[model samples]
Target: MTRTLVVVGHGMTGHRLAERLRALDTSGAWRIVVLAEEAHPAYDRIRLSSYLTGGSRQDLALAGRDFTEDPRVDLRLGCAVVSGDRAERTVRTADGEQLPYDALVLATGSEPFVPPVPGRDLANCFVYRTFDDLDAIRGAARRGRPCVVVGGGLLGLEAAHALRLLGMRPHVVESASHLMPTQLDAGAARVLHRSATGLGLRLHCGTAVASIEAGPDGAVRAVVLGDATVLESDLVVFAAGIRPRDELAAALGLERGERGGVLVDENCRTADEHIWAVGECAAVQGRCYGLVAPGYGMAETVAGRLAGRSPRPFDGTDTSTSLKLLGVHVATFGIIHPRGGPAAEAVFAEGTTRYAKVFLEPESGRLLGGILAGETGSRTALGPFVGHRPPADLEQLLLP
Candidate 1:
């Protein structure tokens, strides 16, 4: 008898779980039902900024024809699981259809965190997350006018770049001392700061938006800074951070992490044996990883376990990140910051255009973490050496 596997959420990780499960369960032991809240199937959210610069929705799609056409998979788009009865082993959709499952997986991902400043709900203020959000931003964006972006992290920088692509002047406001405060160190952020400024983007670090002031039409006219500075703006975008989407957990009486996410064990299994969770919605061992790589790893692990394979326990995942912001290459792997006492570090820089640093164990030459900014050509070569001893000639690896 084939078991029914109902997966709530069809983001990248959810799609990954379906793909992996189908491949592993070749015996047709399980039929998959994926319920997605969005009208469209899974798309590359990471490249969402490209849509403002001529990339189409099809270009960002992660699912292929083969996956969509699979007979054993029921892909229900625009169907949200409103609630569930854990005791009855079923979930009810928005349309009042109940789905029974032998096992259920929550891959609901995350939602963008919008700060609670006054006038944040104004017509022109938006949050950068979904394709629909981008569409709204593009419609509100005016060429040659100033746009303010809250947060200087990865998503914030991406939004600023999209505004620039639309011929709008972008000013990024960050409460931290520098950009990408969580990912890059001070020296690397300085290099990134130079690169962003070179691209004509304005930077306002160490300050927060006190409030958004509205125009006569009730849309955003300007933003007041914490230090009593006001920045005139045509629009505002909030990309501060993300919080896990674990709303369904509350109704099901499922435990959650302190910071918000479905609490799950190493195998991505919840307290109830019939339920499991992956991706941003899941807090594996009480930690939520917002990156796609770790989410993918968790998906694979759950798929393998469901397929009757003994998968390794997921203690943690590679937190490495590599991306291009305004044409500047940046990458961070392993531990970017040293904990406790100061650790030995190797540094290299080429004026203000490039910067690279690597942390190593004090006694042994084992690599701990690293950061590269500007031309990050060595990320691919240097990635494998993390947590292991790098080659003797470390200088060559840091060269731009």
Candidate 2:
């Protein structure tokens, strides 16, 4: 008998789950129903900044008409699941339509985290997230005007570069001591800092935003820092962080992670047997992953289970990240900073235009993690050797 699979969100991970299940269910064992909150179909959110720089919406789209028009798939755009009756195996949408499902998967994804600073709600303040958010920012952007971006991480830097493309002077404010603190060490951050300044972007590190000061018109006028410095600006973009969109979990009475996500087992299954979760909204084994790769892994795991295939258990996948920010290459793999007092030893190298460091297992030279900045061509070769000993010609691999 064919079963109905109801998916709550149609973001990247949710879309992947449906695609994977469709590929595995060649016998037509399951019919998929995807309800997306956004009016548009799933798009490539990783390249969202490209939308600001001459890339059309079509360029960032992940799902085409072919996928959406699949006979076995029911794709409903602008439909949001408001509540669910777990015992009844049914979900209610915002439009008052009820959906019955043999199984349900939640992929609600995440939202931009805006700090609780005063005047943040004033006009000209934005958060870098969806296509709509980018549209709003572009509408408000003024050429040659100062735009302050709160958060010095990957997304923050990306937003800054986008603002630069819009001809605005971008200033980055990072609460952490260095940029990309979660991924890069002090040495690597210095290299990134030089690159950023070289591109005419201003940096304000190691300080928090005291508050967003509004002008007489109630729009952004200046940003006050915790150190008592004031930066005059007309626009502010908050890319501080992201919080999982698990608000519906409360209505459904599902358990949540300590940090705020639907708590799931290694298989991405919640306490309810019929319900599963994937993407940034799920906390597998008490931890939540914010990267796209881990979310994809979760989607694959759940898809395999639904397809009746015995897939690999989802303990956790590699959290390594390799990306180019503002034309500067940065990559971090495995464990850049291990816990418990730096048990691993690191081999460091520096050059005129690059910086590289590799952490070894201290005894057998097993690769623990590494950081690359400026010239990151070696990331592709070094990433696979994580947790294993690398090639004997390690010295040559570090060369720029």
Q: Number of clashing residue pairs in every model?
A: 0, 0
lDDT of 1 at 98: 91
Local accuracy of candidate 1 as per-residue lDDT tens digits, 1-400: 9999999999999999999999999899999999999999999888899987789999999889898999999999999998999999999999999999999999999998888999999989999988898899999988999999999999999999889989999999999999999888888999889989999999999999999999999999999999899999999999999999999899789999988999999999999999999999999988998888889889999999999999887756457888888778899887765666677998888877889999888988789888999875568788788889888777777873
List the candidates' TM-scores in order.
Answer: 0.96, 0.96
Model 2, residue 244: C-alpha shift (Å): 0.3
Q: Candidate 2, after superposition: displacement of residue 316 in Å?
A: 2.3
Give candidate 1 regions above 4 Å deviation: 337-342
- Per residue, candidate 2 scores C-alpha lDDT tens digits across 13-107 of 99999999999998999999999999988999889999987799999888888788899999999999999999899999998998999999999
How much is 220 displaced in model 2, in angstroms? 0.6
- Model 2, runs deviating above 4 Å: 337-341
